[model samples]
Target: MTGSFLPYGRHVVDDDDISAVAEVLRGDWLTTGPTVEKFEASLAERVGARFAVACSSGTAGLHMATAVAGLSPGDRAVVPPMTFLATANAVRYQGGDVVFSDVDPQTGLLNIDGVQDIVDRARNGIRAVLPVHLAGQTVDMPSLARLAKKAGFVVIEDACHALGTEYLDGNEVVSVGSCRHSTMAVFSFHPVKTIAMGEGGAVTTNDPDVYRKLLEFRNHGMTREANQFQNRDMALDSDAEPNPWYYEMPSIGFNYRASDIHCALAHSQLKKLNSFIARRRELAARYDEQLQYLSPILLPPLRIEGCNPAWHLYAVRIDFKASGMTRKQVMVRLREAGIGSQVHYIPVHLQPYYRRLYGESSLPGATAYYAATLSLPLFPSMSDGDVGRVVDTLAHCLGMN
Candidate 1:
């Protein structure tokens, strides 16, 4: 673990996970089947959600959630500038506009003050607000929920970075996907995420209508239930009875359904979610303690009031301006020493496509934050020695030694 190249993030799959996938493959069903439902049920229960809809990727999950939130053409959703493009792209996927909101430069949190300013300025056209839990740090959902309520827009939590994350409601802890604040909490099961399902994601909601729409949208908008059908008059259905094979497609939808093979691994991983997060927190604490003294690198924010993070990525802002060296130079030095690092984002509004569409808009806080942020290697599988090695090498790169 000391000598091997450390990645910014990685999945931990034990024998149990392998056996689960193998058992599922050996079964009669491989795609949508019992395993998928079991995974969904397990996810829903774990996240405190009333329903969980499995989907192809986090992007697809966000798309479905946005659609459920009424993010259609000519509407707009306010999103922070500092996040993966998928957060805004999902809004565009529904043909809705994305209005950029700035973030807190130090913590990378979507500034609630900035959000309120955007909402107060815009009299109308904003249909939803997406607050991303960047780097596993849960946003202040309670306050954001209040803002959405006042603004008359739906709230959808882009919780891809936050799975085991939770927040205290005075004393009672609320899970991230409980939808206790937002309309729906979306999650990702990518290999690099807190959970690994090869390629999968899910949407968790308490609203039955949103849950129903999520299910229908993921399955090509086709429903087999006769009661939900629009055009009931058909040879397959009659007044007294219905055909077993009859199905209906009322609206356009995508094939965003995740396969059972993926869900098998996800369910297996879900069993160890708490432990995985525990180890990740341990590693992150180790990094924070060791790297705090280094001048060139600002350690990640270890705590937020009322929130408990899942420790997805240990993103530290390198003081490149103070160090008189480029972030690229520090990253190269770390890579040469077998340590991996990454930039969490480059401000979605500045992306090539977004730039073209928005015609060169700027959010100063997100821009300044992006200039210094770098994610150091932090994963559940990393040992204490590995953590020390990373800190030592990073210090050396910054001339702290």
Candidate 2:
């Protein structure tokens, strides 16, 4: 606890990551170049997806996915209220409406029942379901996929917290982001994620058309393919054709491409993703074992029979009444002890903007989660002593001897 202030989450950069970025900086291209393509390919291979498109951020990936899926004004996308605002904001970015769903009270993951309720109640325009994998836990994708099919909606997984998580089927661990159960999956490469790349994201899809549209959308709707262009005769019509630079903009898009520098860093981080996930799980186990006797705090729910979490966050629920201290007070006490603690989310539905949009009402599960949740420091770089200090400080604050 004496070294320095601990953060709830932090990036772990190595010499290789720095060298990779330096190499990219020295190269000719910086944006939308070979390094970006290599990173996309690497991610697709790693996730077992047919295609992967790199973007400026996780929100950008979500927006592109929604737009490409034909979400537009008056349409609705179902989203869990327990996630970050971006999950719902992406829907609004495409002029689509957001219908808030509740989360599981214990896991803070999207409640399948709430999602089904929203789907059944939709009068007309609901088009997609964006289920978030909160805190790096994998959602029940197979079951959700069945619901999506029955409800006639596209499934776009907001997998920002679950890059290394897997969906288990008995003894087999099926990798997430493989799009095995959804139309597409989105991931964030923010500094706090399993693999850090400063600021970037990607979309993984098995559909080729969706992949092509994502590529075009991420790059201002510009396409280099002559075959796909509207006017084929444009190539033959000009003498100085500018090396077939002639392209078409069928839809208005954004310049949301990730830079080569970030891609290089992300590539290096991806190489160590497995080990990072392993370490996170190990730390989570330590917390579970040590904190079991603390009546004031509740650990995150364990994995179901067919799920393996990436453990991107080590969130615990604090019972203020039992602990004799509110969440904020506990957080302050922990900070005084030189440990960093924070809340994972303030349910999106309760945010100022959403309050205006949806109005304040009873969201029992999400509100409950918001009131109790706290994220402790968790990262691969944390040593055993660091873990001990965090647990000890928390125990002291909670009066758990």
Best by TM-score: 1
* TM-scores vs. true structure, each candidate: 0.97, 0.96
> Who wins the lDDT comparison?
1
> How big is the RMSD of model 1?
1.5
Cα displacement (Å) at residue 160, model 1: 0.4
On a 0 to 100 scale, what is the lDDT of residue 55 in model 2? 93
Query: Please, what are the lDDT tens digits per residue for candidate 2 over residues 266-330?
Result: 99999999999999999988888877777536565455556788988889887877778888788
Q: Candidate 2 local accuracy as lDDT?
A: 0.86
Superposition TM-score, candidate 2 onto the true structure:
0.96
For model 1, name the residue pairs that clash: none
